[model samples]
Each structure stands twice: as structure tokens, then as C-alpha cells.
Target: MTQDAKIHHHVPDAAPPPPSSRWSHAVEAAGWLYVTGQLPTDPDRPEAALPPGIAEQAELCFANLARILAHAGYGFGDTVFVRIYLKEFARDFRAFNAVYARYFPDDGPLPSRTTVGVAALGRDALAEVDLVCFRQSGG
Candidate 1:
């Protein structure tokens, strides 16, 4: 099979990839989907205001990621790894976990994750996240 057949770029229908942006929302190849970092920007209203506070920002990040996953035939259960960035780690870490756990709750398999404090983020977003999702060769 050709490489294009092996790797599928999943651009969420809900949010068209930015006209001149430099990334795909997700790319699937070799049973894995590598998702791009997601911000809390509204898909329908890219210019809308963002909610203030870590909890809300974290929730939005996940929400945005979930949409991309679905478009690629993946879900939280398919996530194998994640990376999180926060403008204020010390102040938002605990609150961010409280919100994050809802997706990978105690009953679900929590993906490996690393969170770091960042000096800044685009649009000054408080948090941003990205993930890798996998599906077994046949499953």
C-alpha cells in the first residue's frame, strides 16, 4: 500500500484546519494517531473569548482533543500518552488533575503523562495538551 493509504490525516470536520496553518490535527500511521496540541479555542467560533481559570481551560483542551480523536476513529480509551503544558504549574496543577481525571477516571486506564510549567502559550492560554492514540494492528 502507498504511504497515503497507510497514513491518514484526520482533520476534524467540526473545525477545519486553519487555512494556512502548519499542522494536521492528527495523523494515523502504524496503528498510532499523533494528535497536535489543542487549545481551548472554540471550533465554531475561533475568535470567541476563552474562559478564564485553569479548570475551564483544561476542560476545553480535552474537549478539543476529544473531537479530533473521534474524527480519527479513536477515543480516550485509545490514548496511550499525553503531554500537558501550563503557564502556571504550581497554581494550576491540582485543579488541572481534578479535571483531567474525569477523562481517565479511576475506572479507566490512565495514559502516561508529563506536565510541565511553560513560560507562555499562544493567546496566553493557561493550558494546552496533546496526545498519542493507538489501535492494535487488528483491533
Candidate 2:
């Protein structure tokens, strides 16, 4: 008989709660972690108002992503890829990049990324992000 790899559906207490019951914040299997899209929603007070401006909003999104990654024993260093959704791609792209560069420094390893303009996002947020991470062990 063969054994099957176990899967984990995680809703980290330190990360923002999922907006709906239909999804988890992250799902893990094998050596990979798939982090659901993170909005600027406050993890400690999810009902709070979102930050204003592209820089603040993007900062919040990265903060939220950081919390989710840490909860899974991962960090930006372990991130392999990222996908960002922006409400105003042309206007916010440069500002967002400024904030993003802070997390993935030029001297450090950076994850592959895709950023696209989106018509909408949950909570009417200006930005949202998701991550994909890989590790050698299933920790």
C-alpha cells in the first residue's frame, strides 16, 4: 500500500480572517504553500477602515502577507512567486513598486511577480496580493 501526503488548510490567527467561509487563508501540501490573496484589511480589527492612498494600501497588503507567511513558518525569503492586483495599475504601479522594493530588497533574493489591473477586489480595496512558497520539507 502507498501512503498519501497530508494536506493542511490554515487560517492563521495572526493573519486576517478570510472574508468568506468558502476559503482558507493558506493551503499546504508536499513542500509548497499557496497563500490566498491578502487585502489591506486589518488582522487585529478586520472591520476597520482600509488605509488610504496607494502606498499605504500596498504597505498594508505586504504587512498582511508577511503575517500569513510567518504563520506558515515562511517569509519573503522563501517566496517563489507573487501576484498582485491593482485597481489603478498605471497610476499606482510606481508607488506600489516603491513599497514592494522595501520588502524584496535589490540586494536580496526576490520572488517572481505578476501585477495586473483589476476592476475590483474584496472590501473595495485598492490592492491585494497572493504568494507561492516552496521549502524542502513539508513544515
Best by TM-score: 1
Q: Give per-residue lDDT, candidate 1, residue 99.
A: 93
Candidate 1 per-residue C-alpha lDDT over 1-139 given as tens digits, one digit per residue, 9 for 90 to 100: 5434556565645445556777778888878899989887788787778899899989888888888888888889998999999999999999999999999998878899999999998778999899998997666
Off by over 4 Å in 2: 1-6, 15-19
Candidate 2 per-residue lDDT over residues 110-132, each given as its tens digit: 89999999999888999999999
TM-score of every model versus the real structure: 0.89, 0.88
Task: Say which candidate scores most in lDDT.
Answer: 1
TM-score of 1: 0.89
lDDT (Cα, 0-100) at 96 in candidate 1: 96
lDDT values, one for every candidate: 0.84, 0.83
